[model samples]
Target: MRVRIKGDVLCTLLLVISLSTLLYSLLRPTAKQDIAPVKNTKRLKNPPRTAASKKYYDSKVTGKVKLLSEDHHADVDSEDVKPTVPPVKTQSPFDFQQYLSSKDHRNFSLLINQPNKCTKPSGESFLLIAVKSIVEDFDRRESVRKTWGKEGLVNGVRVRRVFLLGIPKNKTTVSLWESLMQQESHYYKDILLWDFLDTFFNLTLKEIHFLSWAEMFCNDVKFIFKGDADVFVNVENLIHFLQNQNASEDLFVGDIINHAKPIRSKKSKYYIPETMYGLGIYPAYAGGGGFLMSGVTMTKLAEACKEVELFPIDDVFLGMCLQRINLKPVLHEGFKTFGITRPSAAPHLQTFDPCFYKDLMVVHSLKAAEIWLMWNLLHSQQPPCSQKQRIKKPFHWKKKKTKQAINAVTRLQVN
Candidate 1:
């Protein structure tokens, strides 16, 4: 009976121990449960995420995208993302003078074949007139041919006119124009053709080529009248003037500008940069509109030009050459480069007048019609205006008084 009682006690003790272990296990925290509560707390702290927000968050966490700030992207639609613009390319400054200096002078070639014109000329030819004309200036060339360019005896001296030209720019019209030029040459026999482009800058090349031609062909020619086609040249007066001047005098005469400064404004037609001519002041040069040079002076000037670098401005370049050779251009009042001014008060407003241009060797900026008119008026037997009626101050006279003076003069001359 005692042994049965002890076994019951031990069974009771084993049941109590089992119950205690079960209670301990039920109260203890597990790793999974602790992690689940932490996740729940984190979810509560952050707002409930939409699909886009979730995707964005995932991308942000993975560092897969660079998104604009909330403020920037707020107004922008998701589909309308702004693209970045590429930077612009900057060009280097163009150095025209340097480019000209770098070129080989020996590469220049003559296109036209007028080998015998300058060579076959008689020893009596006193002046070889070279009018620097462009290929496209057919009208101007015609005007010149008919007017001042008509070759004949002037003041008992033989004068020859030759138009210097370069290649045309228009490729399509080249053949047609060339054919016309050939016909013109055949009929007139007065065109000097070179292969280079006829640009304002390349006028120096024309001068150089003409000089070279003169050196080879008409070396014994007494004088060369280098002028433009637009200018109205008083060939009669010019010849007379040349005859009067000492032939031995190294004559280079025209309207000379002594203290002209280089134009710096880029927008100007005469714009010259420091790169082209670094010098502040330009040497005195005859207004390139028209100038006379003795054969000796011409040869020396050509030699001087050969040693100097090519300058774009034809007049300025010639001046530089003259400076190098220690030759100075003689300034003359008869050479009117700025054209003759008309009297403001005169009844008949004319841009040109026979009386005003009677004594002047050159009057620039004359049109085809005006040139024709002047040619006719000048050649007429009766003088248009008398010496007493002629207006003296062409440049500086007051408008009203000058006009009154001109009217009085005109009436007096008529009476």
Candidate 2:
């Protein structure tokens, strides 16, 4: 009985040892797989720079992609989509010098392969260059011209050149360009052009102004006014302002916005970029409110322009160029840059009158009729009866004060 029991115990121990050995062998592989040793591997080989090779690896993958399309393509089509021929990238054709010499200097030359079809104007020549855009309405243009045009010779002052530029339009903006050119072409002979060609090449409009001014100079233009078309420049007043103010190379006369910073807002038409004009004090330059630049100043400006890079914005760019050469922009009090509300200062004689033409230099953003009226007021042989007013005030201060003084003297004498 004891022998049989011992044999039974040995058999049980052998069976348990065999089972444990089998379990260890199965679990050992799983443990090894779970905790496998890491190894560093070499990177894949790179393809060549050519487009064909680039398709294989660089720009595109020419290899087949497994598709599970509901409507499977043919086996051949599914194989791979390869390029027939590779495209090539080339250099741009922009000649800076030739572009500068072109009659129309505004707009980018790099993008547009074609030249301006318009001819270089000649005979009975005067160049009136408008920096901004001309409005579509011919009436507006004619109205301004009638007022500003030289009446034979206004008090011995001559209107030599008149060029109007509409806002900038590029090749992409062809429609705008066509319309603008058409509007001016009908009436104006010497239509001057300007664009991003200077700015793209990093050249200033001052250079264009310089070149145009040089071409015309004293022979054509007696006084050159550089301003926005939107501005209603009292041409007669502007001429007087230039002549009476002793216009010279060092002198620049205009309505000045005095601040380190221009009024910039997203909604405002005067929105300037932070990149172009960073936050800081800006030196006061003449506002776009019709600045009267002397022929002498134009020459100086033209000469100064050769050295400076083109800045995008005209007025500030002009200011910067002037600042570089130590030319200061003179603020004319007669110039009403930002228009007045009737509530502001009453129109004093010699000071600007919101009512009558009390030495009004330039009024900007005027409608056609308003421009006509202003012009008529300035030129008409008849004196205007009374100043137009939104609100009529009693007691004319200038006359009433004189009468009061006389009355005081009489009363004192009687007493």
Backbone atom clashes (below 3 Å) for every candidate: 1, 18
**RMSD versus native structure for model 2:** 16.7
lDDT of 1 by residue, 1-415 (tens): 9999999999999999999999889767675567755665664576446565565556523212434346545775643343221333432233465556654563477666566665455547688888989887889989988888787777677788788998876647655877888888888888888888787777888888888888877777788899988899988888888888766658899988898999886545567788768889999988888999998898898788788888777898899889998998998888988777666665365556687678889888888888888888888876676545555544444445578888999999999
Per-residue lDDT of model 2, residues 30-70, tens digit only: 88655532211111122124443333343332223222222
* Local distance difference test values of all predictions, in order: 0.77, 0.51
Alpha-carbon RMSD to native, per candidate: 18.7, 16.7
Count of backbone collisions within predicted model 1? 1
Candidate 2 residue 142 Cα shift, in angstroms, is 1.7
